[model samples]
Target: MTVRAANAEALRRLLAAEPVLTDCVSAVEAIGLEPGVVLHAGPPIGWQVMCAPVQGAIVGALRYEGWASSEADALELVARGGVRLEPCHHRGAVGPMAGIITRSMPVFVLENRAFGNRACATINEGLGRVLRFGANDETVLARLAWLRDEAGPLLGKALRRSGGIELRTLMAQALQMGDEMHQRNVAASSLFVRALLPSLVREGTGAALERLTDFLAGNDQFFLNLAMAAAKAATDSLLGIPGSTVVAAMARNGAEFGIRVAGCGARWFTAPVNTPEGFFFPGFGPTDANPDLGDSAIVETLGLGGMAMAASPGAARFVGAGGVAEALRITEEMREITLGEHPYFRIPAQGDRGAPVGIDVRRVVTTGITPLINTGIAGRKAGVGQVGAGVVRAPFGCFTAALEALAADDG
Candidate 1:
């Protein structure tokens, strides 16, 4: 079969997979993660080259793992190679900004029932001085501890008891409710709470339960990471299809942006990261923003986040797209670089057209159009939380490189 044909078939299987949130487990127990191991977002990079947020997050992970007691100790350990830093994507996982995953952290597990594939993501710690944003101060540590002690275990029990939440179902519903399942997850988060409220209430009592409920209620973007895991589980199934050009993943680590092609195995094509253009929070501006960061772009990989923009007019202003028309333009532009429209994720504004899916490197390079991503902007300095939100385009060089490699193989 032709590479394009194979890619189309692979994407069909990917979009067909129905991922379900089945359980929650510690990174250690679930993925056999161990101490002295830190998983960050994007391609594998060493400590010396890591961006500030990533470096800060690694230090936080070290402290969380009890391998270091202070920022100085963490710095010394990382600089001296006392701990190993790997990409979360390499470990069947996904994370948001900095995307730090540690052994003791609890991760939500999602399984693609159609193909029996699974992927996981760490629970979202809401905005403001959060660890994922590179803050490792006492407040951050205390919040992580509270989640470890109360939320994770309780949610695990509730999920197992409820027989799991159907993630794709939530995604379909959420798209209709104005959530692209990335930058905006208000609907998905609410739906998740609605689905689990009974289980949460039935399985517990008092402050622990109240805290979990409150956490879910307060974090509007709680379901974004879950959507990313679901997308990862679905797309991972498309990997290893010889001749297929479907992109398996796209991620960035402040310093670089990278992508993995379906037929390219583990190889990564990387380029310098691009700064996102968008609005900033109070006292924050473009100068203070880190280059695009996070594994959450997995959502866009599956055709939701930015590609579903026309369906999510409510999210436009927040991500720098001024209005619905601008959002539609972004989504329309993506269709040119993608293989086809998604079969399930429909955009109402586009007359129920499927969201664009299957990023094609050849088309991307030929058109000089990269995938669009809507994301949170972390502060450039370590330890500062999210400073703004915006839209970014994956660097064109990554696609050109991937296209060149594919051309060489085809010959």
Candidate 2:
């Protein structure tokens, strides 16, 4: 077992799995996801190096896939390619920010149930102008068509009548109620609407249970893209693992900033996408942000956003830090480039320890210290949605090119 202790025991059995939100289909039935195939986020790009909030969410997913008919004919059919962009982590799926995913939207699946594996995302359209911050106007295509016609079949019939929804026990009770689940998912969106409020009142009513209870009581980052599709279904089960320097998927697409390593199977060790810094929003700043975009940093590859910013001092004062001892000194500089700790995402100010999970691209190129996300700045051009909230790092040339491609696969 010495391929780096079998890659730290395959990332300690992928941080001891347990994803579970079960279902809420339709990115063409949870992942068959056909039609025009748009899924965006980071790494597999095109449409002429897309960016302006992923070309305004690919012209709001080509007008939510009618194929066009405005947003300038969906940017002239995505500048004449006519959709088909790909890379919602090559489709197990994960979206947030301009992480677009189209074909009749409504996602949120999850699954990992100790690795049966499945992910998917899509539903949160709460923020202003929406369409994952790219804002495909018309009130973000009528709130993505009322989250695809009345809150995705009443939250997929209250997630099949609550047969599922353990998402790491609502991310360990939303990191003890302060939520470090990527830019604060306010107590995991109030414990996922109090476990879908008894099946959203026994399957909704009156404007579909008051527009799914005012879109989950006004989105406190609506459980951050279902906790980034349950951290991409629990780290896509530690990707390939060969000699795993673990760090599986930390996306972005407002330009670039990828990374996928558990033995580098799916490649993508990108760079460039930076521009975060912090605090802005009353008339915006940093020249109207947007650079680091979404896949909601796959919840810092499964530890908790910003590697559990010291158990989230209100997500380190909403990403600008200056409290809880600068969020426990940025979780002690992310426990020196992370390798382990998340036995259950603990972190009560670092004494209750545990939340730093395996990011180790050779300990981020021997501690150059990348990976400190906590984002949400978007709106550089697109329709001007989110314009501030900060901290962003991940990109020391994607951990020195995944440590020079794991030292050229060290035979």
Candidate 3:
């Protein structure tokens, strides 16, 4: 028989229990209500000062919504402060990549009735020339149109017919398929393709099917953002828990990298953001990379991305293709500051033990082991998109100050 306890402590343990997938869904669920909802990039921003990626998405959205004839016209309205700019999380949504969510766009909706909340995120249409990454070229705009007309409707209909796919199941399986669920998603992408096939096949085959296959094949990193959204869904549930020291979010916005600790509520401790070291596509080099940006940090909260480096040996190219031993060593160092092993994702080499579970505030304070981040490098200058990708660490000063503040609070 299962033992029951009556107390806040018990509740904390219980709430933190359940598979990671459940927690991930909870974050997505927290965002509530409807399509056509405009989710912006970065923190809450006024109508003015929206970044390029978000701006690009907004422009595409105008076209998607039949509100504007061209991006130039769309820019005029956005500049004139006509359409609304809202936070994605506020509307039960999350955006991966460039993270621009607009109303009328089809989103993968995850609902948690137990908590009376829902989370939504736009589909990952694979990589390149897509709006999320700030690609708003004519071809990109045309593809977005096709997605809204062909891909979106067909997939949305199939999803609706199937009554929605559970993301937790996909998360659980993806880890096994070589997805760190944050930095790498090869396995998750495969699993997503498999789960989506039956439904996709039913939507009927033609240029659409061919397009779908090509989309999946072309964009290998598609599911990382989805998993990050799901992870965001999960970690957000743990927010505002009384006296808990868990971290709710960790992210960067090109200018700064920051994190939130559960015990302190919504305060963020940020460090001067640094550049990533990654292998670029042909003709690209270190000079091309941009400093990291975006809010898809929900990945780190789930214990992948930089936390599960051992799972992503191939990530070295971005982080500095040094050696597998160095990669293993970096992942192992994560244990120095982590709390426990993730009950859901287990490292194959660790005798199937769960991947390093939590990032402990105490460990950070005591050991001063800042977390490592493997990220794509974007150009510092605007409009360059991604120049490279690689690994970097949380600026030590950020952790030291945050830890010091936490210590003072306890004292």
lDDT by residue (86-135, candidate 2, tens digit) is 88889889888778888788887878877698888888877777777777
Candidates 1 and 3 compared: the better one by lDDT is: 1
Give me the runs in candidate 2 sitting further than 4 Å from their true place: 11-16, 22-50, 54-94, 97-130, 136-138, 141-201, 209-228, 231-233, 236-243, 260-269, 272-400, 404-411
lDDT of 1 at 234: 87
lDDT of 1 by residue, 215-264 (tens): 88999999998999999998888888878788889999888999998878
Give candidate 1's error at residue 72 in angstroms: 1.2
> Lowest-lDDT window of 10 residues in candidate 3?
1-10
Ranking by TM-score: 1, 3, 2
**Which has the better TM-score: candidate 1, or candidate 3?**
1
Deviation from truth (RMSD, Å), model 1: 1.0
TM-score of candidate 2 on Cα atoms, chains taken together: 0.34
Model 1: residues with Cα > 4 Å off, grouped in runs: none
Assess each prediction's global lDDT (C-alpha) against the native: 0.88, 0.81, 0.61
> Which candidate gets the maximum lDDT versus the true structure?
1
How far off is residue 195 in model 2, in Å?
A: 15
**Model 2: residue 61 alpha-carbon error in angstroms:** 18
Model number with the top TM-score? 1
